[model samples]
Target: MSSSSLQLPVIQNWSCHNCGGCCREHLIEITEEEKRRIDKQGWTAADGIATERPIIQKIGKGRYRLSHQNDGACVFLDDSGLCRIHAKFGEPAKPLACRVYPYAYHPTGEKSLAVSLRFSCPSVVQNLGSAVTDQRIELQKLGNQIVAGKKRDHSAPLIHRNSVHGPQQVNWPDFHRFLKAFDVAFADTSVDFVVRLMRVLSWLELVEQSQFQTIKGDKLNEFLELVTNASVKAQPDNDLPLHRPGRLAKVMFRLLTAQHARHDTEADVRSGLSMRLNLLSAALKYTTGFGTVPVLHGSQSAATAFEDSANTSPEQHRARFAELEGEFNCRTAGIDELFTRYFRVKIQGIHFCGPANFNTTLVEGFHGLALMYPIVLWLARLRAVRNNRSTVSLVDVQTALATADHNFAYSPALGLKSALQRVSLLAKMKQLTSLIGWYSR
Candidate 1:
């Protein structure tokens, strides 16, 4: 594949600001080749790498990752919040994971790869730096490395899969039709973003039930339009109906939210039994939905990275879980635009589902993506109340997004059967929309 065939999200801009958040937050696993190369780099304690631990730690049989310092920063990350390896050995000398911090490449066509940004990076969430389209040369280089030795022929994920119907696969062209429909649906600025999400969810139900065996090209586009129009007729405007999620649904949603909110940095891992116990306790509190919300550790880095002024210590104002349920007026133009860009990037880059996600069918993965709106808003609400405010500022949403998304598709727990079931159950019980409405205030 040539760099000319690479697809980039024009709506997004990103340049590394050297916040060092990714270095602190992520455990970078290296390929066997990368491991041998790093070893050859000959990092030592005299080079300011941690002396107590080996620069690369064997995490499993024949598997290795860059070790972390006592404070949880990557072994190569220096006091200046830059990669030691990159400084000594140039950019290409760094591991592939190190070089590809926020960019996720999904195989879109036989010769093309679509690019998506991981919102966990503060710069990505804030839409900073040069436009992604402008970074074509650099991204293409990385894309080349990613596809260097890989098979060129890749199959598109099933459009709709279930136990009853098995799998509904589509050709790349037809698959792209669905992506176009999704982009169009979200691109409509006339509707509230939440309402747009609701409409999509309404139509995806139709998509799941209908087979795409004969539907291709124009016919598939026509079918999408009919369902999308029906969804508009059903929703029409922002006069969205509200229904509070049932008790069981709320409990499940909170647990899911807790998973996104939880931070398991290497420092936490090094804490061993106590860290596990604390997580267990936090999970229990989330399950019960009572008392003060257990303070999660990850959001502060996001707040710091974005320079959020309203960011007071969450510990000082530990909020009751009940407080987050209140109205916070989340539907602003700023927020809508932000979410639109986020969703469009995901849709265009084929990041929301398919192989980029956890091998979920299109409808199933979309439902999971839709749930992020509520989860983000809900977390934003928590930040607002904790800071002694009734309304959420755009920064609050930004910080919250950067926080929760750190685990979005990357977390092992989120890919589990139970986590996926939570999404299905909420959508089935009609609680997903309610949760969106309730949290959006």
Candidate 2:
């Protein structure tokens, strides 16, 4: 029940560098009370707040969003990339969402919360800040507010496909055990990311297959050990295969990638379609065997087809794998730290992997915050691939993080299932690895 038990990484400190990225990148929604609060601040054209059209605009019937300036920046954003509200009144004057940039909260269980970073902010990607542990008091206050009066939904089933055992019911402690196994599997530096992913996937598969009733304390531990061993043994001779995608897969990949092409205005969507179409065509040509078709159809067809196009020799493959390991090592390090803290925060606050995932639990209200992680990673991978760079840059990662988080956080039109499915496909395609390879090239 103690927040410390969640093993959350310490939050030392974070001061916004005032890149104004979040202001430009996000559509901020406010409650009715916030609207009245902002109105009370009394803005006129002379006060530097837009008055011709109020800074706040009604999004639909009853919903409202902070309006953007003519240039698409937040109305509160001034010429120097500073928030007018922050400049005038201080940080507290900003809406909760604006104030909480980079830090996200999700339900873990009965009485806990999970804290994750947006990664969309360049500051987060650069690993700028004091250790999160330092921010405990502040974060705890926020967590307490979010989880106030929320009861544990013990009847909510685990996300695994199979039923978990024990008619007595599994508690948060039991769930933490499973999460511990997951974290350890991810932390295995000896294995490549794909191998680690494969290991985790395999373990999840087993968890799905076994009836919960059949799994007891020691049996669960044994199952984890067995799967972990299998994952280690199944490590690919080279890094996992980056196949020239199938036709359907190529189309899907391009469609997905096209979503990342930046559009400055609504008009840009139409004008930019041709450029995006060309990019998609080129990407598909390379990824759908057109680039390697000659070799595949040529004299040494079978041999060439089976050959690793990424590396020509065993030494070369090892070298490439080493490079990949380094790339993943750096990229995932911050992410792992962020997620561990995230899960722990949620677990301690009792916020993750349950009714928060679905609408079964009452009192919490439906907030699809759980899907943020996968979406952020997916977009970050896309940005890496689009740039054709090898390593994922902190800035681009932050951009993707911001993009996905912005879209998912506010868009009521999008459903949770759609978001989750998209993430599932990217994971299945090993999009992260592919993006790393694509960017590296």
Candidate 3:
């Protein structure tokens, strides 16, 4: 494996559908070289980019990035959801980051770079575009430019944090073994994806309890196989027990979901007392645990649902939730396949953990990844309620997923120590499983 040869998720496929969501949603930071090149190209109002505010603004004393228009679109982004640079000077003239909107590249091994796609893109959420594997040449070329002068050495990922055997760290070979086992278990189509997640949690529990200093090479593979079989026997197929989260746990989950579903793309604003007060007010509602779910960007359906439910009567919200108790868990080929490809892409691209996350250990990271299921389902249920439907649709899931994923790994609030601690605490209290079961309905 080498950085020059991109490692992509075989199970996932993506292509830009020119929706322009990325341009609208992200602040594009450019490099010194990129800034210089753009300066040389000489963009102006004639190019249709904003000139009132400098097209490029200094982010720091020396760092700069493209500025956004008053309406919040990137200056380089045209009205048609196209890049002005691409339309004018060609794709190569655009910044590297612009060229790689949904794709994230991470150094996986000494000489390898693993590829992952962001679910924030609507097309990506819908599994639109070409197969990821088929884009090897273009991705490799992109990879080359990304790592042109980068070094080959990379740090090994953490397997478990503060386990009974102490923190577990392994070389690339052992790390890859764990990833392979995870990929296989997660991709199993025989059972629901939620059940597969529960089983992985069971398997990781075993791994954490063992003395993994000697668990290497073929022994690790054997250990994974044994644990997988044991977990299968214990959980069985479609045999999950219904467990409701405690009231306190529900409050905690509501708060966590509020944080996860938050979309912070506001124009830069100075700190003020009013902003603090508004945050405090929102916090109060999040802690209440029985009100309308907090509104979020990219979550129009959910917000509309909550708004409609909230105004009608308190019973409306409760009745909607009651409706979910029976129908939420049902699965179909289309809905099931989206989650299948989603988990596989995360596992295959190594995007759910390591440096890509908030430096979480593999076990902790998996816990966060598993939570996405319930979070998406909760939001999807809200969408169903909005549409006056009892069952969740594929579009409901996609919209819900895109909304939650908009913040998942990218939100600063989620990367905080307190947020990470909450995830760990939920697992210990058995609330994670309860939430999973309840949401699975």
Candidate 4:
């Protein structure tokens, strides 16, 4: 099937600036076909390709990937921050994985696909360049290629199947009805973003209390409207409650935020006893949440002072981190717009729940998504503190966002059952709402 018929996000702008960051960050695996094709390229020193090692390394039995230079960049990356393969051969000559980065394709249905942008790409995060709609031709071709010959017999994704909560089993059609209502609420600019989220959370609680088996088709729409109205009455306009997260929840959140911020680039070979000890020490620091900020590796970060805070006096850590709290306001209309676009795109693309998120219920997936607000805010604060500023610039927020989204739904650490449960627990304890209100201030 042609990918033109596939679902695409209506609100997004992205164009690669050729930062060469991906080439240095990701370990690209190639299929056997890609291997043979690359071999046929017959790269040599004469072609400006490195020959110190085999261009392709065997990662596992019959699994192969492009090798890296001593400087930890893809072997095809030239000194000018360009691909030697593309320069020598062409874009088609590159491996499939290499060609399909920053943009991900997911099978939303038997015959439908959804395109999701990775904020890990600075360009995507900044919403730079052209509208994604303008690139439909290229994206369509790419999506079809990605799912070539794959079966199109997918069952619709579930809403709350077998969950340890109320109204667990919901039909996909009814669940999608809930999605549309939530998306509308999120897109509503009448309330603050946090307030809109809280309102949705309000109605969602009622939806869970009611039996959804009796709700389908137009009944589900009416059910949603009823709950939404009741929630509006309950929450009222612009009235959101706030409280501090519990110590335990805060500790767990800090650890998760650390995992979100940290990255393992191609250059990162942190293994062996040293790596274990480093992680242990980092975990200890994250658990306490009292020291200076942890270093988010591989971001080429400009926030160095915070990273080396331990070397400073205890008084300095206390003073600097405290300064990060009150007085260093980071929230701005532009920042809110960035986050709104991000959430809307994820929702519109159907990339926030179900199979797109480890089979998490809509509420659970949104709990994780809501956590991004405070996480980004915290990282932005850290960035400002490190630069000896009391304000967060757009650059600070953009970098922090890229850092946080790197792990949002992609990190194995965040995907474990325990991690998923932690997010759910935060929502259960109302810490999710509290964190949003606290950090937004």
Query: Evaluated with TM-score, which candidate comes out highest?
Result: 1
Instruction: Judging by lDDT against the true structure, name the best candidate.
Output: 1
Over 249-283, each residue of candidate 1 has an lDDT whose tens digit, in order, gives 89989999988887788998899999989889999
**How many residue pairs in model 3 have overlapping backbones?**
0
Sort every candidate by TM-score, greatest first: 1, 3, 4, 2
lDDT of each: 0.86, 0.49, 0.77, 0.73
Q: Which one wins by TM-score: 1 or 3?
A: 1
Question: lDDT, candidate 2, residue 28?
Answer: 84
Q: Give the C-alpha miss distance for residue 64 in model 4, angstroms.
A: 2.3
lDDT per residue as tens, model 3, 1-441:
234556789977788767676776677888899989999998777777777788888989778878877656788878777888888889899999889868888777877888988887777777778898999988888888888876654777688866457878888888889889998897788898778888998888887777668888999989999999999999989878988788887777767777776654424222346556766676787687545444334433232322323223444433333444456544667777888888888888888888888888888888898888888888788767756678887877887787787778778888999889888898888889899878876
Model 3 pairs in collision: none
Residue lDDT tens for model 4, 119-213: 77788877888999888889888887888866653655555433445536555466568768977888887767777777877776676556666
Which parts of model 2 have CA positions greater than 4 angstroms off? 1-7, 10-14, 148-157, 162-170, 216-218, 236-244, 259-441
Off by over 4 Å in 4: 1-4, 161-173, 270-272, 298-323
TM-score of every candidate relative to the true structure: 0.96, 0.66, 0.91, 0.89
Superposition TM-score, candidate 1 onto the true structure:
0.96
What's the CA error at residue 342 for candidate 2, in Å? 10
Ranking by lDDT: 1, 3, 4, 2
What is residue 431's positional error in candidate 4, in angstroms?
Answer: 1.1
